[model samples]
Target: MQNLTQAIKHLIIINVIMFVAPMLLNMDLTNLFALHFPKNQHFGIWQYVTHMFMHGGFYHILFNMYALWAFGSPLEHMWGRNKFLFFYFSAGIGAGVIYTLVNYYQFNGIYDQLINLGVSAADIQNVLDTGSYNESIITLPNETMREFYSLYHTPAVGASGAIYGILVAFAMQFPNAKLALIFFPVPIAAKYFIPIMIAADLFFGVTKYSVGNIAHFAHIGGAVIGFLIAWYWRKNQFTFR
Candidate 1:
């Protein structure tokens, strides 16, 4: 692997500090930085950007920081530091927006249904406040009720969305580049690997698979924005050198 570029190294350092600071201080940083439902009391405008730097666990940060160094350095080398940072944040913010929009869609479905079934706004607020709802007040099916209950309280965290954007940009810039997967132990070309990963996220997002704690739509959102930016740059023959 190539040595880390200045921007990628700085990002990794910042993320490490963010991850370690909360743990060392015995502080719960999730409520303050993780992206939350807009209606949630913890929701704040700053979280749109901050959430990109927050991770849920050690492995979470490990994978993301590794990807940032592995994939992002090349982009920074090609696009220069300023453009690279712009693309990174743009994709991240775009991911947050799209993730929120999708959450709103699913949330509204349950919200409208609950209202029609005579569930009160106060009761709904209780569920958001405390991830548990009174079954007596909610007439929806058990599964549907659980879905709504989880959606309102769960906050999205981590840099996976922006990392997905980086992966997309990497594939665009080096389609023929060969990459290997640890579990698969097979060297696959970037053109093949990247699309397959995106397709998997799409499938999981639409089907709501048992994949734990992943914001699939956020990955899609980042890729979508990243693709647009990459395509535009490629189309215009944009280059730093």
Candidate 2:
């Protein structure tokens, strides 16, 4: 294993603490620290950053931190500590922003449709608050209701977004680097592997192909920001020093 770069080391430490502390203390920190819909009662401004350090489960944190150590360390070594930290947080926050905006678009569409169908704002608020609706009082299509319900109640947690950013930056800097995934088991150039991952996320996000709360759009958002930053720095001949 490679020795951790300074910023990456601190990040991994924070993430591990965030993951383990709640379990040891017997407190539920996910609801408070995890990113929630801006309109949700539990939503907090600080969660934009905090959510990046929070993970939902053992495998979630393990995968994210592994990616951080494996991919992020080289970038940190290249960009220097401060620049790397800036890039990490910027991509993470940008991901959250994009995710929220996408959710808003979907939520607004559903809200407008419900209102056109004569559903009251109060009824909508009640449904969002209680996670249930009186079907007799607000008769909408079951799928539509479910979508709205899921959007309002689901909280996004994990470092996947920032890790996606790191992955993109790594690919940009070392396009010819060989990467092999456990599932694919074939070594591919960084350029090829990264794009394939992003494309898969795009497909899954559009189709909702899987039933889990994977934030595919957030991953895309991070990749987009990471690419933009890396491209700009390259174009400007920016140096780590």
Candidate 3:
């Protein structure tokens, strides 16, 4: 495994600075880290880059930092600072793009369904205008309102997608690595563990089985991008071994 390098230090510093800048400048930095539904609402296209720096809170950054320390140090040392930085941002952006695409299709699907159901043209316009389902169907019953709320207002915040990408990278390069789930005595090989985790996310995303603001698709997006990246690298003659 590789050791922590300057790139990791630089990333940690940049993230901390961005996280603190919001408070210092009297602006909300939270939106910079988490992608919102309304395209025009964010700082700009640059938020896609800065968003990786802003985290929701302590535990949010904590988990990401820990994962970086665990999986990224090796990657950084192996790839060097410049390459590592490129890989990190690429995965981050890839996650964001894929997430938006999925949301777009689903939102359009709902809009089409509502149109067929004869929701007033005004109501449909409001939903599309504000990007909020609740705002769209204020006249609906309580049961329907519950469903609308589930559709929007759940902004995903965190660096887990990129971190999950790093996890996939590490698992691919070191399939024999022994890792234990939190509080579990058993150690699982990286090869088996990572795939199982990805499969679980896909299953849950498909079923919408869990009730929470988990960006399961984003996680899968990051992992898929990471896998593709590793594949591309190897095909072009880059290999950790």
lDDT of 1 by residue, 27-96 (tens): 9999999999998788999999999999989999999999999899899989988889988999999999
Which tens-of-lDDT digit does each residue in 56-153 have in candidate 3? 77777877877877899988878777777777878887887787678767765665667777787687666645646553445445544444434444
Model 2 ranges off by over 4 Å: 136-139
Per TM-score, the best of the predicted structures is 2
Off by over 4 Å in 3: 1-3, 21-26, 38-40, 127-152, 239-241
* Candidate numbers sorted by TM-score from highest down: 2, 1, 3
RMSD of each: 1.5, 1.3, 3.6
Show pairs that collide, candidate 3. Answer: none
Note the Cα lDDT for every prediction shown. 0.89, 0.89, 0.73
How many steric overlaps are in each model, in order?
A: 0, 0, 0
Which residue runs does candidate 1 get wrong by more than 4 Å?
132-137, 239-241
Candidate 3 local lDDT, residue 86: 75
Which 10 consecutive residues of model 1 have the lowest summed lDDT?
127-136
Error of 2 at 47 (Å): 0.7
